[model samples]
Target: MPELLIDIPSTFVERIERLAAEENESLEDMAMLLLRRGYDFAVTRPEVEPDRSQRPGARSDARLDWWREARFGLFIHWGLYSVPAGVWKGRDWPGIAEWLMYRAEIPVQEYEKLAAQFNPVKFDAKAWVSLAKRAGQKYLVITSKHHDGFCLFDSAVTDYDMVDATPFKRDVLKELAEACAAQGIKLGFYYSQTQDWHHPDGDGNDWDFDPAEKDFAGYIEDYVKPHVRELLTNYGPIGIIWFDTPKGISEEQSRSLLALCNELQPDCLVCGRLGNALGDYATAGDNRIPEEVLDLDWETPATINDSWSYKINDHNWKSSVDLIRKLVDIVSKGGNYLLNVGPTGEGVIPQPNVERLEAMGRWLEVNGEAVYGTQPGPIQGRADLRTTSKEGVIYLHVFDWPADGQIRVEGVAAQGARLLAGGAALPVEVSSGALVISVPEEAPDEAATVIALR
Candidate 1:
């Protein structure tokens, strides 16, 4: 189908204006709806959703079709950093544990010794996948190789990998992939494309390897590209290749790797950090969500706790209510939420993270229709009420439930309304250009109450 270019007739404009006035929507918004009606496709008010995914453009968008629908994902950051647990020299280190190597300024020789102690005996891939699945995450992205150059998967390129170096000589990634497949969850790899602190030719090791002596291109060809090839071919149908930290990768260098990924798995999406701004979907700033609705498929990677990796001292965990609200906010803005959990050295998800995930899962069990496979509603920027629509039904996610029985939707008209948590009919009235949904005095869920508007 061609793009939806609305060329409304002069006579139709008057009719649309009346309808817009009735719905409290802009005349232009109603006109877009009329235009899209002639051709079936979703249209966002204020701005029409462009056919960036299907039309002739970057191949990334084409592959992002499934990702947009996913809406939620699990991000695992586990490695030797888990061994440190944010402690260096018996002193508590601050910030993310994944940055342990750089933060503590540990040399390659000393850091290599930690692998011998890297025995995650309790690490069960099935359990991890099950946890993520229960949390209602459509996909899981684990750190295959972080900036520290410690490989979780069996890598032929270096002896620094789990299989080659670790005491628990099992391929963490292989098990994770198999487990994800068995549990019917999509899996992706978060490979550190640049800034391999352990490798001499890799970026971000000025103390160990001199920049002048390092061969950046050779590092890409020998280690980075080949390792990526191994991951793609070995893993069964990867959803994404999440490359992170663009230290020194040029545009051409990044494209070369993306091309390799495309050749291997045509549908595999690349992270936005895959330097040169070439990726399947846009990645929002770490732990940051959009202020308003976004037309493109973007994702916000958030940590369950203060640190991406486990820290004994980092007790600051996001409450269940906060996580649920964040999820709702991201979904309302037409974006996916990739919540991170850093496992302990023993490869255990912290108890706090587990509890919060279960809580979110329970909420999703009831009000999932408002999230999964839903598109952004016509209403864009509003904190009090966010919108997401599926088919013709619009979902009003009320952040602050109305104290009074009457719930007024400023610019929406609903045929009928029902509270999502419980199948109770919400008395709905379509007044002059507004939708009023009647609810109980007390809100069902304090976090975010969803009302289904048809």
Candidate 2:
């Protein structure tokens, strides 16, 4: 499509921007909305939804039911950047290892050399999917391509991919898709649509490609769209197409990518970072959980440790207890938790990550009913206690057990109560117009104990 240039008043542009922010939409969407309203007024007819049911591979809202019920997932960040492991020329970068190429300001040619060394010989698709299943993760989203423009899957669009660029020469995404299917876990892919440092026409390579002379449209049509098509066509029923860092992408481009995903696989979801607020689900900021419950579908993507990719010096890891609590907190607020694991260049998930995930798996083995397929509880903003509900039964997740052997909750009357983990009954009484449940002094589980109320 050819670009349409129009001149609008500066005041109108500002107003459009404000409206977009208020509605959580893009400025272009707002402008188009205004145009649509004007046209409706002139036509004297009510607005109608586009008839998409007849379209090829038409999308259905039913596809998202599984995602809504799935409270936990795994995120993998692996690419050429893992080869350097945040150390470029003997200097340890202090931030995310995935952004090493841009942070170090390495030339495109120099960064391309990393692809030759990007041999993940130990990468095991079945083992990775098995870990997610054991951790009680319902889905897995891997980085098909990162901002560094390195691809983990085979891409006919470019030879700058794992299959053709490295010694391992394997399509990890293909193997992962197969493994996930066999394990009954949903699969997703993370592709950096706008930012491709190696491609001159793509965004975010100012060190080499002059932005003024770049043909971003060419990058989108010739490269981005093709890559996306191949992913949706090759991968069997992808759970999500996770795009990141919209950068300078236009609303039209965002919609085009979203439409393509819909056309290829109607069930596959598009994340919020696709830009223009066109995603099927909203994505929270990195490592951030909402302070209050959200009415819409949303998710929080977080790292097990500080860096998303492997960094030899970054030993700081979140404890299993903390991770469990975080998962409970997110679920209580009607959101999904996508925890990340950064594998080494040798294709090994760090031992620390493995231990933490195993611990989480053990915790979920006992209390998974409280986390999975549950809705947000009526209670809100309680630090010590969070709640999840399913089939009219409420489950209280106690992070900090009371020492007095009594836990009181207002505005709720429990006919009966029992420990979800152990199925042991507890005494419940109505006192001061509140339901007080008597329990043991010591918590049944340190990482958020679940008590079911009937």
lDDT of 1 at 351: 92
Stretches of candidate 2 off by over 4 Å are 1-60
Tens digits of per-residue lDDT for model 2, 1-454? 6877766545457768989999999988888899899998656521111111112231245667899889999999999999999999998876899988887778988999888898888999999999999999999999999998988889989999999999899999999999999999999999999998889998987777788999999999999999999999998889999998887888898889988999999889888788766777777777877788876677889999999999988999999999999999999998899999999999999999999998999999999999899989988898899999999899999999999999999888779999987799999999999999999989999999899999
Question: TM-score of every model?
Answer: 0.86, 0.87
Instruction: Look at candidate 2 and give me any clashing residue pairs.
Output: none
State each model's CA lDDT, in order.
Answer: 0.84, 0.88
Candidate 1, residue 235: how far the Cα is off, in Å: 1.9
Tens-digit per-residue lDDT, 371-446, candidate 1: 9999888787876878899999999888887677787777777778888987898788777767777789998998
> What is the TM-score of candidate 2?
0.87
**Candidate 1 total steric clashes:** 0
